[model samples]
Every structure is written in structure tokens, then in C-alpha cells.
Target: MALRACGLIIFRRHLIPKMDNTAVEFLLLQASDGIHHWTPPKGHVEPGESDLDTALRETQEEAGIEAGQLTIIEGFRRELNYVAWEKPKTVIYWLAEVKDYDVEVRLSPEHQAYRWLGLDEACQLAQFKDLKAVLQEGHQFLCSTAP
Candidate 1:
């Protein structure tokens, strides 16, 4: 059986006079262990928990962003399958935008640091191709959905 996990591609829009894709930024947390790679907050699913619930819980536990502070984007979900620790793992991600542009991010011990970065910088820091692709896809989704 594949190990399943879920997370949110959390982003915030700058309060700019002119709104554009450039004014959007993604939140990525740097893991304290492993290779210290950066990625969105996520964790393994616990028994009886829905995927979205796990994502919300992990986001709060890892990044300290409460569910009330985010607006989960509809119709935008990405799933990636890979091998980790000799086992098949599947990760599901949904896009979420911070309601308050100035909301703070408090990281837990599992992550050493966090950054809100633009699409290009975020993809660079994400490292893995699949994760970078997810970030890019989320960016494009947000851009296309922007009014």
C-alpha cells in the first residue's frame, strides 16, 4: 500500500495598488531533518482523517497557519506519486490563499525556517522536479483564476 500524505500550497497576495501574478507569494518550510529541502507543510495521514483534514492539520502544526486564515481554492488539486524510504508514497496538494496579506508564519521544530517566495524563487528552493512542478501548476492556477 502506498503511504498517503496531504498538504496545501499556501500563498498570500501582497496588498498592492495593482494586482498581478508578481504580487503573489508561496509559503515554503525548510525541513529540519533529511536533506533540509524546502516544501509546503505536509504530513502522513492519521487513522480516520480525511485528506483535506490532514492537510489542514499539518499546515497548522508545521506552519502555524490556522484554517480560519486561509481560503482554500476550489477545483485545484495535484497528486504526485513517488518512492520514499523504499516504499511507494502518494502526496496530494491543494491550493490555499491567505486572507490577510500581513499574516505571520510561526514554524514548528520539524521545520527550521519558512519563506514566502515568488513563483521562480519558490520553484528554485523546492528542489525536486515534482514539487517544483506542483508549485508552478499552483501559480498558473492562481494566475488564471485571478480577477
Candidate 2:
């Protein structure tokens, strides 16, 4: 069976535009182990947990962002499948917006660092094609739906 995981693609919109750029920024965390790759907060699904539940739980554990602090965007879930460590891996992600842009991020020991980046920088940092595509799609979705 493929290893299944779920996570949130958490982002925030700046109330005041910074440098006249798009007010959106995405949150990314750099892992402490393996290749030290950067990704959104995610973890393996525990027994009997729904994908959304696992995404919320992992977001809280990995990024210290509680469920109540985020607004999960409808119609923007994504899934990616790939090989890792000679095994198949599948990851599910949902788009979520931080209710407060200033909410503190307390990283767990799994991550060595965290960054909030704009779309271009985020896509560059993401490194993986699938992840970059997800970010792009999420960004477009938010832009289209914004007031």
C-alpha cells in the first residue's frame, strides 16, 4: 500500500500591501532530516483518521496553527503521488487561509526552519514540480475568488 499523508497549504493575505506586490504569502517548513527538503506541514495518516482531520492535526502539530485559526477554502484540495525511499507515497493537501496574518508559528522539532514567501519565491523554493503546481493552482484559485 502507498504511504498516505495529508496537510494544509496555509497562506495569509497582508492587510497592507507590501512593496505594492500581491498581498498573499505562503508558509513553508524545512525538514530537519533526510535531504532537509522544504514543504507545507504534513504527516502520515493515523489509523481511522479522515484526510481532512489528518491535515488539520498535522498543521497544528507541525506549524502550531490551530484549526480555529484557519479558514479552509472549499474546492481547492490537491493530491500528489510519488516514490520515496523505494515506496509509493501519496499526499493530500487542502488550501487554508490564516485568519490572522500575525499568528505566531512555533515549529516542531521535525522542521529546522520556516519561511513565508510570495508565489514566485515559494515556487522556486518548492523545488518539486508537483508542489509548485499545487501552489500555483492554489494562488490562482484565491485570486479568482478574492473580493
Candidate 3:
């Protein structure tokens, strides 16, 4: 069976006179072990929990962000399938906006560090083709809907 995970692609719009894709920043957390890869808040899906529930719960546990503190963007979701440790893995991500850019991020022991970066910087840090694509698509979605 494939391992399933869910997460939120959390982003915040920086308040500035000129608002564009560059004004958006995404939240990424560095793993505490292995390659120490950076990824958005996510975790394995617990038995009996819905995918969105897992995403919200993981976001809170991994990034100190609660469901109430984020605005879930409708119509934006991505699923990635890959191989990890000789097994198949599937991850689902939903686009969400941080209600306040100033909210604090408290990392759990599972992660050693966290950063909020623009699309280019985030793609550089993500260092994975699928994740980079997800970030790019999220940025384009936000840009297309911006006023």
C-alpha cells in the first residue's frame, strides 16, 4: 500500500504598494533528520481521519499554525506521487493563506528550522521537481486571482 500524507501550502501576501507574485511568501520547514529536506508542513494520514483534517492537524503540529488562522483557498489542490525508501508515497496539498503575516511559527522537534520565501527562493530551497512545480502552480493561481 502507498503511504499517504496531506499538508497545506501556506502562503502570506506581504503588505506593499505594489502587490504581485513577488509579494507572496511560502512557509517551508527543514526536516530534522535524513537529508534534512525542506517541505511544507505535512504528515502521514492517520486512520479514520479525512485528508483535510490530516492537513490541518499536521499544519498545526508541524508549523504552529491552526485551522482558524488560515484561509483555505478554494479550487487549489495538488497531489504528488513519488517513491521514498523503496515504497510508493502520495502527498496532497491545499493552498491556504495565512490570516496574518506576523503570526509566529513554532517548529516541532521533527523540524529543525523554518523559512518563508518567495517563489524563486522557495523553489531553490525545495530542490525537488514536483515540489517546485507545486509552488509554481500555486503562485500562478494567486497571481491570476489577484486584484
What's the lDDT for residue 122 in model 3?
A: 98
Model 1 lDDT tens row, 56-139:
999999999999999999999999999989999999999999999888898999999999999999999988999999999998
| Residue ranges of candidate 3 with Cα displaced over 4 Å | 18-22
Instruction: Work out the TM-score per prediction.
Output: 0.95, 0.94, 0.95
**Maximum-TM-score candidate:** 3
Residue range 4-119, candidate 3, lDDT tens digits: 99999999997666553348999999999999999999999999999999999999999999999999999999999999899999999999999988999999999999999999
Native-referenced Cα lDDT, model 1: 0.93
Instruction: Tell me the whole-model lDDT of each prediction, alpha carbons only.
Output: 0.93, 0.94, 0.95
lDDT of 1 at 88: 99
Q: Note the clash tally of each candidate.
A: 0, 0, 0
Task: Give the C-alpha miss distance for residue 54 in model 1, angstroms.
Answer: 0.3
Model 1, runs deviating above 4 Å: 15-22
Candidate 3 weakest ten by summed lDDT: 14-23
